[model samples]
Target: MERSNNTAVTYDSDMQSADLDHLELDSAQKKIGLLRLILCSAIGIFVFFVSVPHNGDTEIVFSIIYNKLVGLMGNFAYWVLVLIIAANFVCHLYYKYIKKGSCQSAFAKVYDNDSVLHTLLYALGLVYVVLYAMKVNIPGFEGPEIIVGAATGESVMPSIVLGVLGIIIVGALFMPFLLNYGILEIIGALLEPLMRPLFKVPGKAALDAVASFVSSSSLGVLITNRLWRKNVYTEKEMVSIMTGFSAVSIGFAYLVINTAGLGHQFVKVYGISFVLVFIMEMIMVRIWPIKKKKNVFYNGHEQTEAERREDTKMSLSLIPKGCTRAVKRAYIAKGVPSEVIASLKDSFLILPQVLTMLSAIGVSGLILANYTPIFKWIGYIFQPLLILFRVPDVAAIAPSLPVGIAEMFLPVLLISGNIGAISVKARAFVTIVSMVQIIFFSETATVMLATKSPIKFREIVICFLERTIIAIPLAAAVIHLFF
Candidate 1:
């Protein structure tokens, strides 16, 4: 009997030791994760948010790296892009014909999942790049002077296509540090109170807005779409965030201001634009399309009332709670190298499709704005508002307002000649309007469409028009008040 009791005690002691070891291991892992989260999130904040002087320009570290790469590559960068497009074309052909759509490779899946129209666009993009790189105009297929102009090609290739490629690659490589390392959880927890009441979105969405302001609008959409896929946001929230908050980066805002000849008033104009954009977002989230979207997640998960309350429960210890969440998330996240590789793969998979869409749709829009009367006719709709605001050069500037839908920069280009003649107030108004009316076919719109988010092209157009209409009066008021 005594022997039996001793054996049982020995077993109990062994079980207790095992439990203690497991507790020790888990505690160690949590500590390691906390350290990782702090280090990685710090890197992300510095890279995306902190602006430093580089080659006489104050810009973020990401922009510095991108500009340096562009400078080093010079004309060679165009050729590299051509090679990437050509490779995508071959892969598409192989996926369609050789493999008969049976291949399950990630590259094949992404490149082959295009409609016939998109396939044609991809082909056209290849031709466009080849012609531009080789400086050869096709004999029988020469379209218009503007369509075939060296200036036009330069604008599309370097300004749009190369910019997208560079930003996506660089942004993707560094984004894991921000996204996979638990910064969102910490920020989301802290901002939930304000975000829920003002924007009707979770606080994590604040990070998306910051990402767009600091990096590129496309990166913001990418982050939002990724979160949606993971069921972090519902469909309604995704659409609202994409349409409402995915603003252009500050650097691009400066470019728009500079282009409008309002470089002197950049600080003032951008400051007003910053406030106006949020106003538009607050209103936009409560209107059509966005307000009408379903609240179900991307994977069809619905949050019960109980779950929602628990997820959003506020407490006095928010700082500690946020830190705990961050550490827990970090503990489960993939290693830095693995996360980065995965992010790069995601970027590459979408690169071909996005670039092709930008080339085809962007060029078409530019041509329409530069050569056609479609936008001019549309501009007449805004004539009443422009005239009501007592805006100068009403006839000339009205068209620039609506042309922003085609390309954000086209508005400034259309009015460039009048920049010297227009009032500072007028120039500031146009610059602010262009920046606030964020949906443009050339970039942000194309990037949004390329994502798996459920935003239709029609919806994007409606959102653009809505934003323009809403922004005009508000922008005019601010410009008139300040100027």
Candidate 2:
């Protein structure tokens, strides 16, 4: 009898000790998470947003680092890009042909899923890099000046491609600091009221916007698509968020502003563009196409009015609620090192494919802009609007505006040489319009189509035109008012 009593007491004591250990561990994890959330978020902000003087110019730390890296590499950067494209081509070939698309590895899956068109684009990218690097001109094709010269190849390889590669690599490496931590959770929780009503999306979508803002638009689309598949959002919510919220990153904004020769006005250009994107999105969600999308979940069931009403209800005690959610998220976050590695791995898997697309589409768009009259004719459509807005140098900046549909940076590339002809406000106006017109085919559009989001190609095209039309006057007004 005494032995049984002692055994019961011992078991109870053991349970108490284990409970105490669990409580202490939970408390410790919360502390670590809070620290990580604060410190890592600060680091991310400093890297991406804080501007400092470097080499006679004030630039964001991200750009400064990019410049230094470019300077360090010198002419060798061209070969590095070529090698990346080459690797992309070779991997796709292996995955699709040799492996017969049977590989299940993440990298293999990404490469193997490429359509024939994407593979061909990768091949074209390879050819472009080789031609540009060797400065070789094909006899039957356009001359070196057009094919490999300053207007097309030179503009693309050295400027856009390299910038993208550097940004993706560095940005991906540092992205976990912003995303995996608890800052976004806090922001999401606090902004739920405003986002739900204004954007008709859950507050969690704010994270997608910030992710796109600090990182890239494709990342934002990926996040939105994933959420939709998980039934966290309905089809209407997904389409609205994907089309409206996937904005250009700040890093890319810097590239555009610099390309437009308005690098000195980085703060003003980005600030105005950032505000204009949200304004455009707010108006876009209320219009056709997006507004017309059915409110069905991924599995095809319609979202009930009751469910939507629950989602739209605004909490009265937002601060406390936000903090509670943030603390829970922080408490559950993985270690920083693991999060960063995972982020970089994801970035690298997509990097090869994205860079290849950039090289292929960026060069193709620039070629069309430089050598053909198509964009020029398209420019005439917007000439009246430019006139109505009283924007200077309409003829020069007009062609640039429509070219943004091909690739956002093409407009900047087209007008970059006309520094003397185009006025500063005109250049800034074009820059903002290109960014706010977010349906460029090179990256964002391609990624969107790749997802199973039920968005048609025709819808994407119409949205592009609509956003372009809306953005032009709004951008022009802001430029004229502020600059």
| lDDT of every predicted structure (CA atoms) | 0.78, 0.74
Candidate closest to the true structure, highest lDDT: 1
Task: For model 2, state the Cα shift of residue 129 in Å.
Answer: 1.6
Using Cα atoms with residue i matched to residue i, what is each candidate's TM-score against the true structure? 0.88, 0.76
Residue pairs in clash, model 2: none
lDDT of 1 by residue, 1-483 (tens): 011211322222112111222222257767877898899999988887889977786788977876666668877776777888887777777777678778788777774556666667778778777766665333464444565464466568777888888878888888888877778778877887777767878888999998889888887888887778667788888998887788889888888889888888788888888899888999999999898888887767674555344335467676676777777566566778888898888888888778777777777777788778999999999999998987777887888998888788878888887777887877778888999998998888988887646888899999999999999889888877898
lDDT value, candidate 1, whole model:
0.78
Clashes of each: 0, 0
lDDT of 2 by residue, 24-73 (tens): 22466567656766788788778766778877867677667765777688
